[model samples]
Each structure stands twice: as C-alpha cells, then as structure tokens.
Target: MAGQAAQIEGIVVKSTGSWYTVFDPATGQRSRCRIRGVFRLRGSRTTNPVTVGDRVKAEIGADEGDNVITEILPRTNYIIRRASNLSKESHIIAANIDTAYLVATLDRPPTSTEFIDRFLVTAEAYHIPSVILLNKMDLFAGPEFREIIDELAGTYRNAGYEVLEISAKTGMGIDELRARMQNKTSLFTGNSGVGKSTLINAIEPGLDLKTGAISDYHHKGKHTTTFSEIFPLTGGGMLIDTPGIKGFGLVDIAPDELARYFPDLFRLAPHCQYYNCTHTHEPNCAVTAAVAAGEIAGSRYVSYLKMLEDDDKDGKYRK
Candidate 1:
C-alpha cells in the first residue's frame, strides 16, 4: 500500500507530515490533502512516509472541490537515508530523481571527504547517477583549498563521474549545471553552508528562497531550508532541495559488499582471491593492494572502512 507508485492520478510536490500538496492531472490543479486514516496509522513508512516525488491517486470529494490521497504509486527507484530515531527505519529522501548533486565547499565550512563518500556510496548502491558540485569558486583564497578542490574533482572524475566547479556569488558554472538539468529531475544537496540556496537563486532567480549567510565566527551555515521542497525548472524537470545533512548513514549495505559501492575500490576487487573478501584482513586482497599503491583516494577508503565498522555495529539500521 505505501511503496507502490500509483500512476492513476496526481503527483506529490510537497510533504508536510500530515498533508501532501498534490498536482492533479485531469483538472490540471493542485490541492492539499491529508492521507487516508488507514494510510497514516499503517506505520509502514519510516520517515514522513510519503516523500515529495511520490505519485498517488487522489479521490476528490463529490462537488466539494477537495480530495484525499487514496493510493500511492509504485516507485522505480527511491533514495533513502537512515531514519533519525531509536526504531532505526529507512527514511526516503526522494523518489524518481535523475541525478543527485552533492554540492560541496572547498574552504569555509569544509565538507569532510567522509561525508561526501557516504553520500556517494549510498547513491551507488541505489543505482543513482551522482555528481559532485564544487561551489563558491570566487572565495578560493590560496593554493591549499584550490588544490583540494582540484584533487576532489580529479578523484571523482577518475572514478567516472561528472564534476562541476561553480561560484554562486560570481555566477560562473551555473550554465553547465543547468544544461544537465534540462528535461530531467535533480536533487540539490550539500552541507548547510555550501550556498545551495545561493546557487539555486542564480540559476532560476525567480524562486527567491531564503538564503542564509554562514556565521563568520564559527564557519557554520544557519538552517535556512526547514524542509525539502520541489521546484520546477524553467522549461522541464524539477529540483528538490533538501535541508543540510550533518551525517549520512547508509541504511542497507553489508560489510562484505561495502567495497563494491566505492567505484575505485570495486574496479580492483576482482583480483582478490576470495570473492567475498572484506578487504580489512583478507590475504591477497586487491582493494588493500590498490590502497597501498595509491590507486584509490585514501579519504574514500577510510570512509569505506568506517561504513563497514558501522555496518558491523548497527546492521542495516542507519545511524
């Protein structure tokens, strides 16, 4: 009942816990409606249950000019994060996205490579194409942060990804990013201070989302986006901007298969003798050998090991 993507009627554009803003296809109108009572108490959904991109059937009240969510449609693919609760359920981030943008900053409020790796691994596991967006190019002060950005871009690109360096302040690479968004759904995500809002304004300026400045004293961004919102791009496709995430715990991967998601690591995994090698202590392990030979970025490898450790401790529940 909860996971099916019903193609019978409308699209869910907004989710506010108790209600969903749905765009009806027949009448070409949008309305806010609560989920059926049975659907709410079903408790099958982990986080708010229905995400913003869900397509569902809405039955309008006879001559009442309103509707209620009757049935949810099945999803082709859904992006999920570990739920923030003791129960440890899976929280769906969004459904049916074309690509996921992990917007990052090189200097101020530096996004740890560990954070980036976790998000990337999760995307890989879910078969989602992901791109790393290096934002705030105008603020690159010196060789250190600049070199770091270059290294990050090279690391991901070598691992077979598209990386775009942009400056929300100077309007540098927004065109390249927008060209990719043409006629496809995209999810813009990053740490709190990486200027996600600023970049969105520069790209489509009409949305005018509340942009927050990072606190100079602490180098942290204030929470400007309270909830995940879906906005239509100029011609086609959609952009779902989610609240800044402090940590991303992958929900459903095993320790043995952890190396498979890291594209760099998986490339070398075939040489290992044991098909199920964990790489921590496996003899003749190709993954470890690549690590020693500098074939893979050390930071990404470290993140992989940490995810294995977490999987051992918490099983499939996202922390």
Candidate 2:
C-alpha cells in the first residue's frame, strides 16, 4: 500500500476554478487534478489558489485517475493585477513567465497608452521581461495612423523594450516574432479584440483558438479566452495565453515605489530637488523637467499621474 502512494511532478497547463490540467514531462501524460483543501499559495493573495504555469506535485488516485495536488512549488516570478470587479483582492495572471507579450492595436479597438504603461509597470515590478507587440499593422496603413504606430513603437523601444510590429491577418513580422519566442516561456496578453489568439494561431497553426469581434457601439473587445492556459510550442518553448483584461490595476505598489517601475522616470528621479519628490507638485523635480524638455514621453507621465490619483483616492491601482 505504501508503494501505491507514488508522487508525480508536473507543470500546470490549464486552470479552471476547482480543476487543473497538469502535464507530466517524463511520461508525456496529462491528468486532471485538484489541490488539497489545506494548501494555499505561499506568497500571493490570489483569487485562484493555483494558476497556470505553476509547477506542482500530485499523487494519482488508484481507483479513479483524478490526481490530488500535494504541493505548489515556489514561483520564480509572476504577473498579477487587481481582481476583476473586486478591488480588495488580486488575480494571478501567470507564473514563472520568462517574458510577457502585450499586444496592442491602433484601430478597431484602440489600446490606450495608459493601459500599455500600466502593464509595463507591473511587468517591471514582477521582474518579468516585457515585449510590446503592436498588432494589426494592416489596419494602421493610413498616413496618420502610421505616424501614431511608429511613434508608439519608437517610444517603447527607446525605453529599453523589444517592440515588434505584427499583423495576424497579413502574417507580417511573424517569423521575427517566432524567433524571439523560440526558447523562452512567453505569456501573451492584451485587451480583448487585440488578437492574442489570432497571433498564436499564426505562430502555431493547429491550435485554432477562438477569436471574437469588437463591439461596434463601445468599440471594445468581447472576451474570448475565459481562462489562462499554457501550451508547449513546437519550436522548443512554451506560451501562456491569458483571457483579455479590461484594466490592469497595480497591486502592492505604493506611491513612492511607483516611479521605480518606470525605467526612464527612475533614471531621472534621483536628480530631483526634493529627496522625496512624488513628481506631482514638487519644486525642481527632474522627472517633470524631463517631461517639459520632451525628454520623457508626455503620455507616460500622464499615465503615472493617473496611477498616483488612483493611489491617493483608494490606495489601489485601478483604471
């Protein structure tokens, strides 16, 4: 009977509330598993007790094949946001991600720069490398839209992030995009209608994940992917696709520590006149000066100020 209690280690590929799909690399097998009732995530106060991309250990049931997760291994890093419509709690997006790809669109469902920066700040705080994927290039062919796309790409690229211009419709820049994701575990995320699933289907054809259309009246995307799931790429890496999020609220970040998440702002902050400059109304603030000098992107500073407002009003980062 003791021998029957063998343990198997696996990576969580999908999470659906009470059930998780774990993939065992050694035997190339998959199993549906549930965690022990007493188990809790060590560090995060997440809505889900377990998240996709988590490494875990489980014991297979003898009579029924359903497994019981006995342990949730420590995560190297994870990306999270305030729980949807729940201000007091947070939701874990994905764990142990090597990189996060934030897909943005210029039209059909415009992605605000504020949204982009908030995501970037969260990625910075979690120590996850982030790449800006400017998708739907085909829609940005007009001269005016082209300028906007170019400037947006240049802004992030100058801020020390890799920005790729891709079109899931036309297959533009797909090879380059695929090359970067070859050996890394990447998490693909963005607002709904930004074509996260479409991009993945282009990168790896057979998945054929569902796609959705934007609301004509609100010009917003409808949620298509309901849960986060991880898939192994044929090219030697893994990818985590997350449900589209309407807003990315910062969690556990204070007003003072917020600037540290913005690379450009953090670099210039030490030069501020006041040691504790919030950069809001402080005299001789270097960050504000940079903004005036056009050294810092104005849109970025606006996003920062918006976050500060949220912090002041409720102490939680939310749109």
Candidate 3:
C-alpha cells in the first residue's frame, strides 16, 4: 500500500487488443495500461473491452509505467456493428463521437450504396449525426464520372444527409471538412481503398498517419490502419481513426424496427394503410408507393428489402 498508485481519469486513445494507451488530459501524459479486471457491457458481448474514445479510470503506479484501467465510463453514444458475418459479438468502432464522417469512394474499389445505407442506418439507430464525404473527386474528370457522383450525392441529400465532394489528394474540400471537425470528436470510417488515412493526413499533416495504395489487380485497398487510435487535432478537437471495414453487419436492431432507422423510409411509413407495415407487400404501403413513383431511390429501397430478407432468414444482415 505504501507504493500504491492513486486512481486517475483519462481517455483511452488507442487499443491493441491486449493493451491500451490512456492519455491523461490533466498532465498531457500517456501511459500504457492493461485491464485490471474482467469488464463487460450489460447486454452485449463486445470483442474489445476497451476501445478508442472511451474515458476510463486508470491507476498509474509510483514508477509511472504500470497503469491499469479499472473502469470504463458510461458512453453517451457509440457506433457498433457485428464483429463478422458469422460471429454474434458486436464491435464498437468508437465511443462518444460528436460526428461520424464516412469516407466513401465511387471508383477503385467502389463503396456500394448498400454499404453506405448500412452505415447510415447504424448511425441513425445510435442517434449520431453522419456526413458522407465523397473522396477522390479529382477522378471525376469525365462527364460519366461527374454524373455518377452527382446522382450519388443527390440520393443521400434527398434522404436528409449532407454530402461533401472532396478530393483528399488535391485538397479540394479539406477546408470545409476541417471546419466541420473543429472542436468535435469525429470518426472516419469506410471500406478499404477509400483514403480515410489520406484524408486525415491531409487534415492534419503533422499527424503523418500511414497511407496505403490500392491493389492494381483487385482494385482493393490494403489495410494500413490496423487498430483504432484517437489523435488530438491541431484545429482544437479530437479524431478517432479506425481500421477499414470490409462489411458492416447490423447488430441489435430488429427487423420490424429497421424502417425507423432509414430516414427516407421512416418519413413515409405513417401514410401506409397498416400501422405496422413491413413495407414489403402490404397494400397501400406508402414506402412501396414512393418507390414506384420515383420519390425514393430504387437502390435504397432494394437495400432496405435486402436487409429485411437477411434478418428474416438468419438474423445476420451483412453488406
């Protein structure tokens, strides 16, 4: 007891499965910490007990090296998805985020609309504000690419999301992105090859986050950011950079409640004849009517139906 360390509060800036890097804002010091005891969330089984952006109570020993995280503070909100298509456990991408910026690309390992929808749905379920950053705008020189980007932006805009066209390689929309991220905790996530690390590096070049290249043969991005870590931005806020996710599988959301998460569909659900409409085959379904009338994007409706079917079949909705 003579050499025991007192309890101190800090933020978990990085998690590498077995150890966590806890940063104390008071002292501006980071200590390598390990879990002091078994910790688990009430109803869910999470793969990692501690994740980036989590505020925890840790003990820094007298020598100031052997730090042990004792507790994880309650999270205001977090983004979660199934750990895998076959695993029942959920993985929290980041906790207590002020904004979630999903970096998407239309070419070179294109980010599918379904994948975007899935991410938005998860954000909606968690009540987190989401912005779609269409990176690699410099590639849209031809009219064909321009049209595609325009349509994609319009689709998300019509659904009540702000879409920003950005080219990370050329600093096209980095200023606006920097302003938006100022003084807030922002999470950047997307499929591999979407340039998440590149964008972050551009936003804060001093960070010099590692960037990877796109595979020529497969047109996929090799993983560069292996673990989640939080960085202090020079612009007065924090950022949580996570590993590039290949698929986002829905977790903890029921089939009947799925529509509520899709903002476009949820707006039209009330007009349906039945109070509880799956929006699949019920007569006078407002959602179906909107889809047929071209009020809703056909691709979004397809994604919704696909999620429903997946949930109905095996309760595993992966995209």
On TM-score, the leading prediction is 3
C-alpha lDDT score of every prediction, in listed order: 0.79, 0.85, 0.87
Using alpha carbons, what is the TM-score of model 1? 0.89
Q: Give the least accurate 10-residue stretch of model 3, judged by summed lDDT.
A: 310-319
Better of 1 and 2 by lDDT: 2
C-alpha lDDT of residue 298 in model 2: 93
Residue pairs with backbone atoms closer than 3 Å in model 1 (clashes)? 4-73, 4-74, 5-73, 5-74, 6-73, 6-74
Instruction: Candidate 3: list runs displaced more than 4 Å.
Output: 40-44, 62-65, 313-319
How far does residue 210 in candidate 2 sit from its true spot (Å)?
1.4
Residue 25, model 2: lDDT of 97
Each prediction's TM-score against the native? 0.89, 0.93, 0.94
Q: Among these predicted structures, which one has the highest lDDT?
A: 3
lDDT (tens digit, per residue) of candidate 3 on 59-133: 878764567888889998899998554678888888889999999988877999999999999999998999999
TM-score winner between 2 and 3, please give it. 3
Output the better candidate (2/3) by lDDT. Answer: 3
lDDT of 1: 0.79
Model 1: residues >4 Å from true position, as ranges?
A: 1-8, 41-45, 62-66, 83-87, 313-319
What does candidate 1's lDDT look like per residue over 1-319, in tens digits? 4334333378888787777888875777877777776765674656566788888887655422345788788877777877331347767788888899999987677888888888898899998899988888888846767777778888888778888888989989888777779888888888898888788888777999888889999788897887777888898878887888777878777776777788888887789998877777778999788889887778877888777777786554232
Clashing pairs in 3: none
Work out how many backbone clashes candidate 2 has. Answer: 0
- Per-residue lDDT value at 23 in model 1: 81
